[model samples]
Target: MSRTTLTLGPLLYNWPAADWRDFYARIADEAPVDTVCIGEVVCSKRQPFYADVIPETIERLERAGKTVILSTLALPTLDRELKYCGSLAREASQMIEVNDISTIPALAKRPHAIGPLINVYNEAAAAFLIAGGAARIALPPELPLKSISAIVAAARNAVIEVWAFGRIPLAISARCYHARLHGRTKDSCQFVCEQDLDGLDVETLDGERFLAVNGVQTLSYSYCNLIFEARQLESLGVSALRLSPHTCDMVAVSQIFRDVLDGIREPSHAMRAMRTICSDAAFSNGFVHGTNGALYVLE
Candidate 1:
């Protein structure tokens, strides 16, 4: 069997333009990831700040022998948002990842890929998309191993990717929680979400750490760590593993995962190295085991 491909998912945060550019520049030069997905998937408001920077970033990544993919918005509601996605699908040279069902029409049966934000839960759904010309489908992060294995078994024509790392994106809302937290409406509030690099952590009234808030996106506080499950996922015929971007030392993070996937380092040793790389990250693998998403199951 071939080695599983490692893909760096799009940056979901709103960092300064320089920071964003520098981050990708470094990834292009140093990260071991085989694929890199860029473009704003979180908020349209954040796009303008780094809009002009994307082309250059893509050029740099492609020059580095990486397959680059442009991702559409996960939630495109407004007419302008819809129009922008339509245009991107019709014009972009690189392969695009469709994050919303609305963008499907724009795809025009073109050879495109599917993002995790789309609700593809079964083999039939995966087959329907592959027949529609989808080259690959990044399965939703919340799926269990059984569902994933079944989908992989049936969709032999398309590459099936698993969400292997980063905080699981739980839900997205029409309302901007970041603006509301700062006493401003979605329209009036400044881009306050940019302040939180990863996301704003939420806790219960009793002080238990809960979820995270990023503008309209609610995510898990615990970062999803699948280092222990990489080999198993590959065994189940998973074609690729996606590692979402975080503000932490991601190049080191990718290298560690690459070593484990390549069988150069044991998962336990890599887990220890990961602690030093992302000390604040609370590792979780329960979702793969069909348990609480926040819990880490070693078996």
Candidate 2:
């Protein structure tokens, strides 16, 4: 079987500039991913801290032979945020990953990618975006194999990518939960979200782990793991698998997925290796299995 492309997704958390630079520097030197998505996708307030380093990182990744895709904010409410998205859209030199429809008009007729945040639930939606010059569509993480196969079969012109690993971003709201939690207004948030690099874990009243909060975004508490479903996704015409960035050893994570795509590593063994790599993260495939998003379904 031909190898499925492994794309390293943009960093969703707010890491210190030094940490972020070192992380990508390591990725450039070692990771086996074909594409690497950069830019601040969660909160616009966090972008400026790392904006100066982006050009250098992109150059490094390009030198490393990785396709660097720039990702827009999933919820760009502010005028400046929208302008940033537009600026990214106008970058003819690189591919833009549109996370919101607000960025669509600016990218009209240009070949761009549709991030998972935009709801492309059915075949019609997939076809519509492809018609508008979407070269690739990364399906929402909650989709099942049935829906995935359906869209992939219908949208032959676009590369259908799936979220293969990392915390599934559930939703984004205008209200900043991180700011609210800190008892500060959104405007005076003081970048309090910087405290939790992996996002603040939200636990239920009953002491069970619930979701995670990152400013305006809500994410799954358990990291989405589809190591076993990789081959099935490949067989169904899925062209790429996205691995979301985390504080974990992503280079090793990318290698594991690449090994599976290359038939050099068995899924069972890959899962075992992942357990060692992401020792603190709880694994979940429930969304893909058509069950509760919080549950981990054993294969």
Candidate 3:
């Protein structure tokens, strides 16, 4: 097996500030991921809660020999949010990941990374970003394997990445579903989304777990597990596998990915170990196979 770098994406959920800090600290000290994207990409309201710890987190990860990329918000609706994104582009000397297209202007001429939220569906889209100083792209999770391969082939100068773990981010809304579910308005959310370390589960009327609500974002119930597809991904020119942060033991998760990538563990054995680690969460790679996004198909 050829070497493929693992990237730990930013913490999406609104975890307690101390818990968030401690999680990154542990990752820095023990996780095998080569790159770590820090900062918030979801709700700006939650950023203030953990904003203070980001600098220390960056320092710690850098000290641990991890490449750190600062992430911007996925939706830049408010003036403050846009300003914040601009500030990150101007002030952050390290590579920045643009989650929203609105932040692209701010990052022009600067080598930046494109987050999965940008929807690089075709070669043209990929080329546009690459021309705009994008050094890497984490492809959208919903894209089929064929499309991913096409984009990867088109991106000669940029490193191609895929979402290899964590829940699939289905959609993001202006309304706060977390607050709506709790009988409150978006303005009065009171940060209740903190209760679920993972996003709050949204079940169908038939009691089937279907989606999760994280403030303004909607996510898939099934965690995206690509342990079996690592070889295929690497062969397709994807040099990086992105593992989004979840409530699970990420250090163990990183170890599993590293072992699989290094040929130290068989894909089957790694999948079994992941099952044990994420017992409550179902796993899926159907989107990559061009079928239902929640179904798992093995080749």
Candidate 4:
């Protein structure tokens, strides 16, 4: 019953600025997570809304004895975006998660963390990042467990983190899906994505629920739940479980994970409690089992 650190990832949804601020404020004061990732990782357009509140949030989280890591945009296109990413790397913060490749050179000489968005499927890639000053690496959610184990062994000295919860961020594109859903182009999107807090659901041609469209990002319809896999991951020597921000009771979620990690509660009990909190969304551990990313394989 070894303890695994819990990290609160940056929010991926388009909630109101006040809601965003309030969520982190509560996290700083109450959540049991060891680290809290701040800043925008999705569309850059949403950055301005909460940008003013980030510094204060960082200060508060740090004062609460929680390690704060600033996350960069997953996709960088415009010159302004690149500049902003560079500024994030250069900031006095010791830890920053680089989601895009462009941030590598900008943060190469400095010490920083790497996010799951940057592919690290093999040991060589892990070594490369570790050599480039990455103290920790959050493996991409799409990677199978075998690859994760291999990377973890390779990164013996570096901290290894996994996406433990939330809707999996499957892909990103220059086009805004919200605009496409509304029959408008990206250039004239008019910030339509702000309407959906948890992202707009995208269905298949046969009317089956498939994925979610959040501006430039594509996410899974099912939330990724790894509560049952906590023991397996701990046995593998994983350092942390990254819980992506969602509009749920995160403090309760963290408590459940803490209980599971502390051996005070069994995985089955944790899963049952999660069901009560996660609403109607299905949970999947398929990617970890090397199967379809959406399949829920109960052990």
Measured with C-alpha atoms, the lDDT of residue 248 in candidate 3 is 93
Which segments of candidate 1 are over 4 A away from where they belong? none
lDDT of 1 by residue, 1-299 (tens): 86799999999988999999999999999999999999989899999999989999999999999999999999999999999999999899999999999888888999998999999999999999999989999999889999999999999888899999999999999999999999998888699999999999999999988889989999999999999999999989999999999999999999998999899999999999988988998889888898888899978
Better of 1 and 2 by lDDT: 1
* lDDT by residue (tens digit), candidate 2, 1-299: 45689999989999999898999999999999999999989888888898889899999999999999999999888799898889879864899999999999999779999999999999999999999999989999989889999999999888899998999999899898999999997789999999988899999999888789989899988999899998889999999999999889999999999899888999999999999999999999888788897788887
Instruction: Supply the global lDDT for candidate 4.
Output: 0.88
What's the true lDDT of residue 42 in model 2?
89
* Residue range 122-233, candidate 4, lDDT tens digits: 8899999899898989999988888888988878878899999989999999988898889998888888988988888877999877788889899998889999998789
TM-score of 3: 0.98
Q: In model 3, how large is the Cα lDDT of residue 31?
A: 99
Residue 162, candidate 4: how far off, in angstroms? 0.7
Score candidate 1 by lDDT: 0.93
> Candidate 4: where are CA atoms >4 Å away?
none
Give all candidates' CA lDDT scores.
0.93, 0.91, 0.92, 0.88
- When sorted by lDDT, best at the front, the candidate numbers are 1, 3, 2, 4
Model 2 clash count equals 0
Q: Please provide, for model 3 over 1-299, each residue's C-alpha lDDT reduced to its tens digit, 9 standing for 90 to 100.
A: 33679999888899999999999999999999999999989899998888899889999999999999998899989999999999889888889999998888887668999999988999999998898799999999999999999998889789889999999899998999999999998899999999988999889999998999899999999999999999889888888999999989999999999999888999999999999999898999999999999999978
Per-residue error for 5 in candidate 2, Å, reads 0.5
Q: Report the candidate with higher lDDT, 3 versus 4.
A: 3
Which model scores highest in lDDT? Answer: 1
